[model samples]
Structure formats: C-alpha cells, structure tokens
Target: MSITQHQTEAGSGMKPVGKAKARFGTGRSEFVVVAVLYAVAIFLTVGTATMNVQGKSAPGPQFFPILVCIVLYLAATLLAIQILRKPNVPDNTVHPGHGQFSADMLHDLGHLGKEEDAAYDAAPSQTPGKTWKTYSDWRTIGLLVGGVMAFVLLLEALGWILSAAALFWLVAYALGSRRPIFDIGVGLLFSSIIQLAFGAALGLSLPPGFVGGIF
Candidate 1:
C-alpha cells in the first residue's frame, strides 16, 4: 500500500485502541483524569466522615485521611476547572502524516507502536532536541512508587524514622537532588517532624520497631 494509506490506517488504528480521544488530546485527558480523581476523593472524604470511630479521647482513624482527602479534592477540582476552561491549544505546526509517510515517519510510527512507547512522538529522535518535545517526568513517578513500596515494606521492621527518612531521600533524589549530605539531612529533618506530629501530637502509634525502647 501507499505511504499515505499506511499512515491513515495507523492513525485510525490508534484511535480506538486507547481511552484517549483525538478531540480530548493530552491536556484534556489530564483534566478529565484529575476531575475523576477529585470526584473519588470527595466520595472518600464524605464517606470517612460518616464512619463511626468513637473510641478514646482522640480523633478517629479516619480523621487525617478525611482531611487529606478534602485538600486533595479541592486542589484537583480547581486544577481541573482551570484546565477545562483554558483548554491547551496543541501546536498544529507539525502534522504527523503530512508529506506522505517518509521512511522517517514509518520508523517513528514503528517506535510509537511499541508497548513502551511514549504517549506523543513529536518527531523522530534524530530531529534536533527541542524544549517542548518532552513528556511528564516518569522517572520522578517511578521513584515515588518505589519509595512508597519500600516505606510500606520496611516501616514495621526499620521503624517510622528510618523508613520515612529513606522515603524522603528517594523522593528528593528523584526530584533531582544530587548532594548526599543535604538530601540526608533534609530527609532526617522531615522524618523527625512527621514522627513528632503523628506520635507526639496526634497520639498515634507509629512503628517504633528496633528503636521502641529509646522513643
């Protein structure tokens, strides 16, 4: 088949394969996702507030989760509203299927088809690297996920102080911190603050683990 036909077929094929609609694009998709997240957050918040946790002289187990949910829902709702109102105008300068699918376009289409492909391929990687061609930072997300997983796994064994310190350092490193001393210091400080807030102020029992006696 001709290159034009191939590109048309490829573009059409991509349309129905994912949740992404051409009309929504990336920005709209992000807005929709945020909106949905906020809706869920609202539900959880209201649900938790209704739960009966009438135990001791302290707030219920749902107290902090409800507070966080309220904050997250509000922030997400505002962001979604802003994005919906000011829909991002995609640069129409570079049409993907224009100029009859050249060898370069075919190569790009192949890469785009891969399971590990980026959401948008601005152009072939051979093109001069432009500032606008980058996607959201997936590395930071990976680091956050890894840190959360590690914190969950190690919290009981290593205790809140160590686990939270490690989580903070990992997240900071993921966000591009390079100075080990600074990262460690900041991590310890933040972890200690969290420890004090949850343990001392909130009267919540975090895993003291090996350091239980000292605390």
Candidate 2:
C-alpha cells in the first residue's frame, strides 16, 4: 500500500484485516476464570454433600460449607454475566464492538484469538519488566497471598475476629480500597459477625485468643 493509502486507513481507524490491538481488557481470560470458579463451587458442593455427618449437632458440619458454596455459585454467575455483557474492545479509536451484542462482536473474539495464536503461541510479551503476558498484577496478588498467610499464622493466636479482620482489610486494600480506617472497621464488623455466626448459630466454639480471654 502507498503511504497515502496507509495514512487514510490510519485516519479512518479501520485495519485492513479487521484485527486491532486490544485497548480495554478482553474477557477470554475472565471467562476461563469464571469456569474454574464454577467448577470449584461444584466440587465443594459435592464434597459437602458426601461429608460424614457424624454428629447430632444442628446444621451439621456441612452448614458453613453449604453457605460458602452458595456464595461461590452466586459470585461465579455474576462474573460470567458481566463478561458476556461486556463487548470486545479490540480498538478504542473507533469504538468497535462497543454496541449491544452483534455478529461483529463475536468476530472480534475470533479475530483476537487468531492474532493471539499467531503472536503469543510461542512466547509471552518481551517487554522490559514483564515476565509473562498472559497475566500480571503481581503486587495485588502478593498482597492477597500475604494476607492469607497472615490469617493462617495468626488465627490461633489472635482469634478469628482479629485474624479474619486482617485478611479482610488486606483484601480490601488489594482490591483498591484506600480508606484504611473505614476498611478496617468494616473488616472488623464482618469478622465479628462471622465469629458470632460460628459460635451462636452453628454451636462451634472457635479459639477465644488473648483478647477474648482477657475480657
């Protein structure tokens, strides 16, 4: 193509082969994540069902697991719906595939898939400081992992309220919550409720730890 033709095409914002670089996030990875979460939810449901109800306790040992499974199912459903509703954003210049669902939107997925297969099949992005292109966000991931580790290490010593509150706070921070005081308060409230639910509603006594023992 001539330089004039190339300039016109660039100005018009339409590539020759109908493929463009992704601007916003593509949902293919998110869809895979949703599928994985749904599978996990299903497995947890089956496991909870097959658990040996050895005690006469009301709600049994499976009660909390059932509640967790319900939450996971609901969360996965919402995420899948969001991904389906979100249109492909291969290019932000002309806002292609931004309208409601249509054939062109589906084409965007296939086009991106072909491009990825051709380009990323052999290796990830070779950009500086980017180890892998499929995913990143290592900072937020590290924060969450650290939070889980802290919860595990502190649960027995600090009790469910403090340990779980710390986990909640870290998670909130990782997810972009900036107000530490309010987030910590909310975390404490949630942890306290979980503790109460476990103790009163389920008749399970978690470790009281130093705070509760002092009081």
Candidate 3:
C-alpha cells in the first residue's frame, strides 16, 4: 500500500486487516506450503533410511534421497523463520454509537470515535470492496491441480521425462509464461538430466516411455 492510501484509510478510522505482510513476505497459505514441504522432507528421510545399500564403501541409493530431503528441510526452515518473525497486531473492535451523541457520550473516550466509525460504515465506497478471496488466482490453482493429476495418471505411460516436462510446462503456463517452446525445452532438459543422474549415479530406474530411446 502507498503512503497516501494508508494515511487516507487511517484518517477514515479504519484499521487495515493484514499488516504482517511487510515482515512475512507472504500470506498464511505460503506458510502452509512450507509446512507441507517440511513434512514431505521428513517422510522422505524416513523412507530413505530403509533403502538397502549395494556396498558399505560407496554411497548408497539413500544418498540422493537423503540429499533431497536435506534441501527441503533447509528451505522449509528458512520459510518458517521468515513467517515467524512477522509481528501481528491484534484487531480492535469498532463499536458504533448513535450520530446524535456528542463527543461526551457514556464511553470514557467519548463518542467521537464511535461517530466516525458509524459514518464510515454508512458511506458508500467509491471503489468495489476486495477481500483475500478476490485477490486469489483460482485459474493458477486449478491449472496446478490439473497438472498434478495429469502427471500422476500419465507418469507410467509418458515416462519420467515426458510426464515431468509436461508438468513443468503446465506450471509455467499457469504462472503466466507464454513461451511454450522455451518452457518445454527447459523442462525436458531438466527432466532428462534428473533421470540420467539418478539412473546412472545410483542405479535408480525411472519409467521409460516410447521416447525413452533418445536418453
């Protein structure tokens, strides 16, 4: 919010709904995402512990999974810290008083504040009111959900490379990127690299679709 806008709202006797955004850098939903990422990291770590090693000397299949989990943990911890540092100001209730009352009403502070609240409430807004839900981009969320579903259903048939590429492309598109060729190329490159690295380094086998021959 700009200085003038905030001043205007304050002048009108209205308290801002969310002031923590300045410190947190994001909203509650992002915190939930961080928590989910943290949980996934822990779960993956536990699963990796049970993986059988081919040899005691060399790094086992557990190495990559454990590494990934560590990265997730680090990311989650940073995000949690960011969210926790933000100071939240408690909301004060606005008690409306009759406009007929003067500055010396029954309340200790008097009716001045109450009259302002009543007037602000009664006035019609020049601009349409907006809430958190209004700001949310449901199209992006729907695209993400659809992408995940498609990725899951087509994983085996399309293989790790193609399925992952498609998922990445879908996510990029949802985020407003329009360069289809570049996005798909980058996604394909990344997916191919991951597949090759996991398969060649730790003997992890990913599903091989029809186009798997190129890799």
Residue-level lDDT tens digits of model 2 in 1-215: 69999999899998558665765456446777788789999999999989877768877778889988999999999987887778443322222222333335556665434554345434433322322123469999899989889888888999888888888888999999999999889989988887888888877777777888898
Which of the two, 1 or 2, has more TM-score?
2
Q: Write the per-residue lDDT of candidate 1 for residues 68-185, one digit (tens) a residue.
A: 8978877897887788787765443222333333334545667324332332354355443333242567888888888899899999998888888888888888888888788888
Residue 72 lDDT in model 3? Answer: 99
The lDDT for every candidate, in the order shown, is 0.70, 0.74, 0.75
RMSD of 1: 11.3
- TM-score per candidate: 0.60, 0.60, 0.63
Candidate number achieving the greatest lDDT relative to the actual structure:
3
Ranking by lDDT: 3, 2, 1
**How close to the true structure is residue 60 of candidate 3, measured as C-alpha lDDT?**
64
